[model samples]
Target: MQRWKQYGGLSGLFAAFLAAGYWGFTATGGALPWAKRSSKALQRGIQEGGGGLVNLGRGIVVAGPIRKGGMMLEFGGLVLLLLLLGIGMYVYVDRYGGFGDGERASR
Candidate 1:
């Protein structure tokens, strides 16, 4: 009999990725209190067009810290997925013998 053990780790990793993306996007402009400040700062900067607005807008983008964090989160998720798959394969092999028919035993 072939035994298949499903690893929920991948799902967990996917969820983490989704959460990180959500936080990143929402942090820029969501229900979060800081989002309001960020939005206002961005708009004001765009309007001013000069030093004040330009600097404010640039500061907002730079201060957000989303780009680098997002990349790290994505990489972490990928690693989690790989780890889960590896563990699942290991469990499957340990329980069901090898990858060939020879692994199966006659009843």
Candidate 2:
């Protein structure tokens, strides 16, 4: 029983580490594909407009500085969410003993 408890604690810690690593990798990796797609779409929208007044308006809203700013905001939000999850996981592991604290210690 005692041995099993120790193993359980270690396993929990390992699981927490794995979860954090996966979340970080996916969040960082996912941003690149989205950024590329957004850039391409913006470019297409700009080219299709062909320098007319309509194009100018479309360009301002979709393909111009606003689009760039929106992308930055999205990327910033993704990074912030990942950071918050990481901090939450760290706190969870710290307080919960990863697996579960021994019953005797809880009192």
Candidate 3:
């Protein structure tokens, strides 16, 4: 219940998550590969001239590493988790209203 304990726990959690993210980023070849991909895409776009900005037939393109590495299921799961979290928060807010003090506002 102490404030210091709460702060320490939060700091520890943040450090753990930051380390894990850095590990993931390094293991996945970091930003170099992505930079190269972006450069090539830009050059190709310049060479190819104009086309329809929104092509319904093409659909959305998943990143090459994720698609090639077969992380689609993990990606989908993360997306679903975030979507559920957002909806849950929305429902909780709608049911309980906001944190504003109604009495203070009326004064």
Candidate 4:
């Protein structure tokens, strides 16, 4: 794996993901609807809501868009996946070591 090949592959993957994300955004009515809903929610909350910032009784509340759009499961799954990936990386680096001074000095 040459450096150029690695960078090129990453660039291609990024472009593909960007295109897919844009397509999905366009197909799903773009950001207009979301922006409108967010503004309305903000105004309504300001006018009619007053409570402690952190309510332990209520537990965790998902964002309004994710909850209302029925994507809570997807959001949760993504969060779990990322959390596992992060923990796995941390464990791997702790056990096998990363780019430490010894490794860098050899190079």
Write the residue-wise lDDT of candidate 4 on 1-107 in tens digits. 89999999999999999999999999999999999988998899899976765689985667778989999899989999999999998986666666464563433
| Top TM-score hit | 4
Error of 3 at 8 (Å): 0.9
* TM-score of structure candidate 3: 0.49
**Looking at candidate 3, what is the lDDT of residue 7?**
100
> Order of all candidates by TM-score, from best down to worst?
4, 3, 1, 2
CA RMSD, predictions in order = 15.2, 15.0, 6.4, 6.5
Off by over 4 Å in 1: 1-69, 101-107
TM-scores, each model vs. reference: 0.32, 0.30, 0.49, 0.52
Candidates by lDDT, descending order: 4, 3, 2, 1
Of candidate 4, the 10-residue stretch with the lowest lDDT total is 98-107
Better of 2 and 3 by TM-score: 3
Q: Give, for candidate 2, the lowest lDDT window spanning 10 residues.
A: 54-63
lDDT (Cα) of model 2? 0.76
Counted clashes in each candidate structure: 1, 0, 0, 0
As a whole number from 0 to 100, the lDDT of residue 56 in candidate 3 is 89
Model 4 residue 54 distance off true place after TM-score fit, in angstroms: 3.3
